[model samples]
Structures are given as structure tokens and as C-alpha cells.
Target: MTNDVIIRRTIEWMEGHLHEEVTAEDIAAQAGFSKFHFHRLFQSAVGMSFTEYLRLRRLTNAALALIHTDERIIDIAMHYCFDSQEVFTRAFKKVYGFPPGQYRRQMMSLMKMKEEKQMEETLKGWFLSGSHPFNYEMGADVETVHQGKQSGYLKSKTVTPAEGEFATMMQQFKADRYRGKRMKLSAFLKTEDVQHMASLWMRVDSASEEVLQFDNMSDRPIQSTSNWNHYTIVLDIPENSAVISFGMILSGSGCIWADSVTFEEVDEKTPTTNLQTEIVMLDEPVNLAFEES
Candidate 1:
């Protein structure tokens, strides 16, 4: 089986059995391997360790449950294997931006609004009452669903790609999957004048740090906006990589803004994609008013 397919299946198992006593060994077994061999391969292939993935999985679960159900905090803590409410609260607060209670309250407000909107639409007899508002509210933001009811989270975004001279600007990643292979992005720099760049900022899946930022530094400055503006960043898709997804941010006065960025790796059978969505990148015109001049 391919590494991406393995990791994807592992996540499937995680979603179904998160309430059980899950371990790296358990995941290794689920993914069809022994711990010793699986650990390294899993980390290298998925860009994250099994344990780390479990923690993230737990946090993601807690966050969703906190909003979806009115279950007691202590129950949530216990279910996710936390030793105490305090511990759960601390970790939840650390992962999300707030305590469980606060997050639930906010989620309720958003869900309420969504439901209200849906109610209005349904009353107009557009569809059937079998549909729900909360579904849209939590869809993308929460667990995975094949089809039917989707979570109510906002979906990915889109933007126009920029153009410069190396000859032309092209959509290289385009939602492609590398499987067990490592892929790199390459763009050309005609000169040494760079006020714009490619950066990768993930939620730093470690409990030890609040956030970590990595900007794949290019050797030359974007001396001129005239060249094709070629640039590239190698993505380390290790089995234990901490990235939720990737994004591209653009800086400059080119009237260019990144829309949603997408890489074609959603399915289990391939290694490349022609589709694109963005976790981050310039899609529309950007506002630098907030940046310090």
C-alpha cells in the first residue's frame, strides 16, 4: 500500500476508535505493520509520528464534540483519555484558542445562526427538512464525511495566480500527491530583489511550542518583477509531519492576491493532481495595511 493511503486509513481508524485505548502500536497494526518498522516509515511518510497524530486527533475530536454535543466537560475529558478536567482544559485551551466552555458557546452562536438561516430557507420549501444547518456549520471544520450532510465550516478559498517573467508563472502543485516521494516547488528569480516569498506556517503540533514558522528561503532577491518569478519549496511529507495542509502567501505590489491553494492528493490511488485549493496563498488582491512599514 502507498504511504498516503496508509495514513489516510489510519485516520479513518482514529475517527472510529478514538474513545478506545489507542496507541502507536495499535495504529501500526491497523495500518498493517509492526511498531518498530511502522514507526519510522509512518513518521517519514506522513510527516508526523503516530503519537503526535493521536494527540492532534484527540484535540480535533474534543473540539468538535465540545460544540456538537452538550456533553459534560468531565465526560469529554475522560473520553479523550485526559486524567482530569484541568488537564483537558489546559490542552484544549492550548490547541484551540479558548477553554472548552468558551469554545462551545462560540460554536453555539455560529451554529444557531446557521440553523436559523437554514430554517428560513427550508420554510421556503427549497429542499426537505432532512437537511440541517449544523451540518454545514461543522462539515469541513469537523470530521470527515463522504457525502450527504457536510459540516458547517467554511470551505477552502481561491485566488488568481500571479505572473512574472522566468517565462511564465505556472500552477505546479495543483493538488498533487507524492505518495512515498518527496516533492519540491521551483520558481526562478531573475535578480536579488525579494520583498515577496514562499512561507509555510503550520499550527506547530507540539505542546511545547505555541507556533513555529518556516520560510523556505530563496537565495536571490526578486530584483525585478519582470522575470517569471520562479521559486520552489521542498515539502517534507514525513510520516509524522505536523502540517494540517499547506498555504502560499504573497507579498508585493503586483495587484496579485492568492486565492485558495490546492494540491491534488485527496484520493488514495495517485501521486499527482490537476486540481488546486489553497490552505494559504495569494488569490485576490492583498491588503498590507496591517503590516508594519
Candidate 2:
């Protein structure tokens, strides 16, 4: 079902079944793809995960219902499979930046779910004549500064990179597209120089004894030193593949943070490094930015 017609046809079917309890298996069977790969492929093609797409679609439908009918807000929320009005309100506020009551009061005059084209502009940290909530593209100007006990800054790579190189990176690691690809991603960092460098590489080979492999510099002959900068890499993976083991060779008493990372799965042409979202806060994120204090 590589044909866009088939994929879209299935999406069209999904459009009619928002209230039905849906699962990845159902979509995979309908789309003629393995449940494993279908999830990844769907996101890559639609620029959002199947689960996320479905949720957004449901919310979008609810948005319409909220305005068109005289139905109670609680009824609309429950009809959309939300457990309670409070839960629905929280999620609505998170995504739409306004409660459903406010939206209905606005007379459906505004649409908060951004248009697809708006994503590219929003990626550039721009919105309708201004900035929006998420600004990952702003990373283009964000240099990797020294955050730990180190006294100096880091030599960061140019945030913007080639499309092909980035595409390969995205698909090679996207578990949906790359589950079959089975790539090994490794990261390294050093604090010896005033400037710390973070290097990431991947090797995808199925013929070898180890289908997937990962080894940080601390594991090899490379030693963790006072000049050593600790780093971590999280794989945004599906729950079915959650048990994959992480082999590590830690040298000191710091910490190894193990948590799932979430990311956008855009079209085949989109670059993986070009983050589709970034969570901004006063405190730095350890997952995206490593700490060596």
C-alpha cells in the first residue's frame, strides 16, 4: 500500500470512525502493513503519529460539535470518549490554549489547531504575525553553551544541516521506519578542552551478530575524566518495543537518566534533526542538553 491513495483511503475511513475504539492493529490490517511498521510509516507520511493524529482529529470534531449543536459541554466531552469534562478541559487548554467554554463563547470564529502549512512557519518560531507556543526551529540560533561545572562554552555544530543527511538520520532512527533498519546510535562527549564536543553516529546492519548496538566513549578504551562530559540519547519508541536493553559502562558516580523521548514523525523528506517541537522552560532539559556538573 505504498500508494498515497490507499493510505489516504484508510485515513478517510478513520475520519468516519472517531467514536470507535481504535487501535494500531486495526489500521495496520486495513493499510496492509505490519502493526510494528505501520505506526512509524503513518507518522512519517502524515507528519504526526497515528495516535496523535487520531486524538487531534477527535478534538477537531469536538470543536465543530461544540459550536454547531446546543449539546452540553459535558455531553460533548463524553461523546468524544473523554472520561470527564475536567480531563477534556485540561487537554483542550493544553492543545488549543483555551477552554472549550471559551471557544463556544467565541462562536467558533477562531481555529486553534494550526493549519499544516503553519507548521513550517511555526517551526521557524513564527506564527500568524507573531510567535506561537512551540519554537524548536529557534534552535538554529541556540548555541550549545557551557552549563555544567565547566568554565567555557562548547563548539556546537551548525544547527541547520543538509536535508538528505537529516532525512537519513530521521528514518534510520525512527523506530517505525527503522525498526526493520535496526540502527545503533552512539554518543560521546569530552570536557578536557574548554569546549565540549558531542558526537552521535549510527550503524545499521542486520548481517552482524548484534542487530543493534550502542557504546558510549566511556565504555571503550576512552576513559571518563575530569575533562569528560556526560551525555545521553533517548529513543522515542513504541511501548511494544519497550524492553530493549541498554548496555552501559559508567565510570563515575553521576547518573544515567533512562526515559522515553517523544518526537515528531514528519514526511519522508523532513529532516530528523530539525526538531518539530521544543519545550521551553527556565530550567534546562537533561534529555536534550547533558549536564556534567
Candidate 3:
């Protein structure tokens, strides 16, 4: 299997059995890899060690439970496999900058203020659309931001199991100024329980809306829960390219936050990550006079 597919399977296994005792051996076995090799491969592709990812994911869940559920602190700790409330609290505070109790109260206070406003808030200069808009929810979240005062959150509904459909928070603008230049689109992404994957996608189109270049991070996906990190998509804008449209998309069931999006022009030294090739340069033609070689 491809590394991305293997990592996706491993992540799915980990998410399914989070409450049980797990080791690198177990996860490596799940992905059909040797223990030693899988450790490096997972870290290289996912940008974090398996154990670290698991710990952070469990702690994230615990934090959310503290805010949303009526579970006690010790119970939450035990449920997430922490040895004790003290250990959990230390880890939680290190990541979230607050103890569980204090974090919950702070989150709730922030949420209360958000609840006082309309449930669906636009993301200002961005728009939302997808195959199943009704199956998704979009909003600006202040309590769970990676930078600035808020970030855009996209949530998928549990009832819709359509893997082909996606929810996207997008923005589009004229690309006349960026024509004939290479563009890099990047953003910070944080995800929770991503079943299929989440991606930073960019597309360049003609005046008629025909796509000229595109990359959706499909070759390398964020298939599991992860801490905040940067992801990017780079594509060259042809002289005829008219519109530049980009977005963060969530597939299957999960939640993702997009923060600090940036678009900039780059020189030819930077390679484009566009999946669709505009030209194929071959050493020579393969067929002549319809004769077999």
C-alpha cells in the first residue's frame, strides 16, 4: 500500500481503539509494517510520532468533554488513559495554557458569548459551498483558534456517510494581477476525528471557469486528528488564468479549523505541487506509422 493509505489505516485503527492499551507494535502490525520502520514512516508523513499524536488526541478529547459534558476531572483523566488527574492536568495545561477546570470555564464563557449571536456566522471575505452543504456546518470559532482572535471551523454531520461529498470554506477573487506567476496557498489546520481526510485546496481557472491548475493535497492528506500545523498548495498561474479560488475542505465526519491563510507569488525556483500536469515532456514519440516496437 501507499504510505498515505497505510497511515490512514493506522490512524483509523488508533481512533477506533483509543481506550484500549496500544503500542507501536500494535499500530505497526495494523499497518503491516515492522515496528522500527513504521515509527519513522509515521512520523515522517504525519509530522508527529504515533505516541505523541495519541496523547494529544486523547487530551483534546478530554478537554472537549470537560467543556461539553458533565464528566468529572478524574473520570475524564482515567477514561483517556492518564495515570492520574495530576498527570492529565499537567499535559493539558502545557498544551492549552490552562488546567482542565479553568480551561472548561474559560471555554464556556467564550462559548456563551458566541451563543448569544446567530449560530451561523459568515467568515467575512470567504464563502461556503460543497456537495452537501446541509450535511456540513461552518462558523468562526474563538475558543478553538490557532492564531488571531478566531478561526474558521467546518463540521461534518454524522448522518451523512458519503465520502465523495465534501464541505468547503472557500474564497475566490480575480487573478488578473497574479497571471503568469507561480502562487502558493497555505494555511494552518487543526483537525479532530477526521475519518477520511482534510485538505488545503487551490484551483486556477479561466474566465469561463475551466480549471487550468489544481491541487487538493490529495496525494498527502491529513487523515487523522492532529495538532495545529501548516499545510500548503502551490500552482502556477498561466497567463490566461482568470480566477484564483481556494479553500479548506473536510471529507467524511470530522471537524477542522483553518487559520492564517496566505497567498503569495513565488519565483520559478519553487516547484508547483499541482496534481494536474499541463504538459508531458517525453524524450521521443512512442509510436510511428502505427507499428509496434
What is the lDDT of every predicted structure here? 0.45, 0.43, 0.81
Residue 230 in candidate 2, Cα distance off native in Å: 43
Per-residue lDDT of candidate 1, residues 236-266 (tens digit) = 3433333322333223222111211222223
TM-score pick, better of 1 and 3: 3
Candidate 2 stretches with Cα past 4 Å from truth are 108-293
Q: What is the lDDT of residue 188 in candidate 1?
A: 20
TM-score of 2: 0.37
RMSD of each: 20.2, 21.1, 7.0
Q: Kindly list the per-residue Cα lDDT of model 2 for residues 1-293, writing each as its tens digit.
A: 33344555566666667787778788778878787787777755555676776677677667667767789999888888788999989977777677999978774453344243432342232111111112111111111211111111122133432221211011132234545223233222332221221232222233332334332332222222232222332333322332233322222122121111122222334323211235467665465555555
Q: Which stretches of candidate 3 lie over 4 Å from their true place?
A: 116-125, 129-137, 140-167, 172-200, 205-210, 215-244, 248-293
Question: What's the count of clashing pairs in each model shown?
Answer: 67, 2, 0
Global CA lDDT computed for model 2: 0.43
The total of clashing pairs for model 3 equals: 0
